[model samples]
Target: MARQLAVALTGAPGPAHRVTLSEVVAQASALAVSGTRTLLGISGAPGAGKSTVVEAILAELGPRAAWVPMDGFHLDNGVLEGLGRRGRKGAWDTFDVEGYVALLQRVRDLPAADAVVYAPALDRSLETAVAAAIPVPAEASLVLTEGNYLLHDAGGWEQVRPLLDQVWFLEVPEQERVRRLLGRRTQDGEALEQARAWVHDVNQVNAGLVLADAHRADLRLRLTTRGDDSAGGSGR
Candidate 1:
């Protein structure tokens, strides 16, 4: 695992003391073996690779860890349309912030050895949330949840941070993050112009909200693509 993380960080430009992916994994591993259910959050603006980092850590940790993304708490498209928020689908108000906080509280309080907690999942293709789609079992000591609003402090979202044991915020260059958002929208079958419009009009607005409370995160990770620098540290 260390070798894989080392290779992933190799050739990335950053300070000599940059925290490696291995260290991140180590932190997660420590939580998993702590003999208690731990919830670790990964947060970032849209396109900041929150899912990518969470998936990598889960892959390394294997069966001891489980994923519970906050995307599952997104309000149904119908609900959004009824609320007249369909045009700004990814905004913080588009999510069921109260429901998400309730789930986090349940996950944090319930003993992993007692029962299975079913979490909802987001069907990106359909852009709707599916209930009871993800099962967090008895043995999964570390629950990793990633999303854009874990650090957000308003609109009923301020309750989320206290439930998490640790949170890592991903920091990607704005240009790169915007590029990824555009690519994702286009890949989801939007026309180029439509994708551009959505990225600028909808996603970027939400991104601003997520980035505002980033300082509350326990760790801040600067993840970059090939030819870019990788850097991160505790509260940096």
Candidate 2:
């Protein structure tokens, strides 16, 4: 099996092995054949391109891999509103961590012969969680889960780390991250200043927590750009 790296060997930097997105996907695809089911985690601060990596991986290994986002377990908006946490919706406390862990356990315990297990997905457009929107078929050997807190240790978040076969932390420049985050906040009709303010007050606080523990990841990948549909760039 070949190793996937983010550096290319020839073109730009000497002694560096720059790899393409396809290279990484190929290596991840190879993991499905490793006997046991593989749970590969991609963790990073918000706006660090975690979802992009998952999208790229899923596109590369459809059916063989399924995405189980931590965002799907986000607490309902009304619940947050009731608790006065509506202003900071993406905080770790705003999510149902136990529920996510349970779903992950099911993904591990159930075999390919069993009926597909349904998983919820976050409807960011509606700012709500939609239940049982994605099904994990019996044949999927790779479960790709991403979020801001897979590596987070507070309030039982540490328990999340041991369940995965591998984990990678995504890195994006702070300025670029802030830019991307502001773009997202504005997508929902926030004014430019409002977006920046929320990012500084809300998003950065959470990002601080994520960055503090990035070194604990199995691999640290600094992406060249945010590679999702709403964003694009050359990735390292």
Candidate 3:
């Protein structure tokens, strides 16, 4: 199946291939019907459109799939404050990695279970995690998870990759990604100068870690932008 997918995506021989969003959705749909539960991970740097790609996949698969974001495992701000890591809130060590791995293990066992498996969700407006906010039904065969560290290795994060069936790394131009991050922060009422500082001091540091491990992904994707929306995928 992986070989067939590579053939479908257009690009010269390289570490990554160019694929359309429709093709990605179709691949996810195929997994949804595969009889047993499957975990599909979408990973990328900050502002790399991982959520946008996952949203498109969910729209196509509907209830057959469920989304579990890694952000749901973030440590509380108070905890960060006490640890003196509040300034780097999105770094690798800021999350509950072991807890996240445990949830994935439970969710992965859904094929043999009858009860709904509840997962935490990150409430962006509140900037905190809400426990048991997203439910994955026993009938859902495809579990879609996205976040920055799915492909990251080290600090207990090495356990994540083994639980996923397939992982895709999303990539965008550095300028565009930084622009999105800055826009997001400012929209949340952060001052422009402060947002820029946060982007450089915090987000980019995390981005470097994610990008360095891009080669570990099963597939690499670049979203093609049309106006304000993503049109599809394009090759490097």
- Candidate whose TM-score is highest: 3
Candidate 1 deviant stretches above 4 angstroms: 1-23, 112-114, 224-227, 230-236
TM-scores, all candidates, are 0.86, 0.87, 0.90
- Residue 163, model 2: Cα distance from true site in angstroms: 1.2
Q: What are the Cα lDDT values of the candidates?
A: 0.78, 0.77, 0.83
Q: Where is model 3 poorest over a 10-residue stretch in terms of lDDT? A: 227-236
lDDT of 1 at 208: 88
Candidate 1 structure, TM-score to reference: 0.86
RMSD of 1: 5.9
Better of 1 and 2 by TM-score: 2
Tens digit per residue, CA lDDT, model 3, 152-184:
889999999999988888887787888888888
- Judged by lDDT relative to the true structure, which candidate is superior, 1 or 3? 3
Number of clashing residue pairs, candidate 1: 0
| Model 1 residue 142 distance off true place after TM-score fit, in angstroms | 0.7
Q: Which ranges of candidate 2 are over 4 A from the true structure?
A: 1-19, 225-236
Candidate 2 C-alpha error for residue 105, in Å: 0.7
Give me the displacement of residue 131 in model 3, in angstroms.
0.2
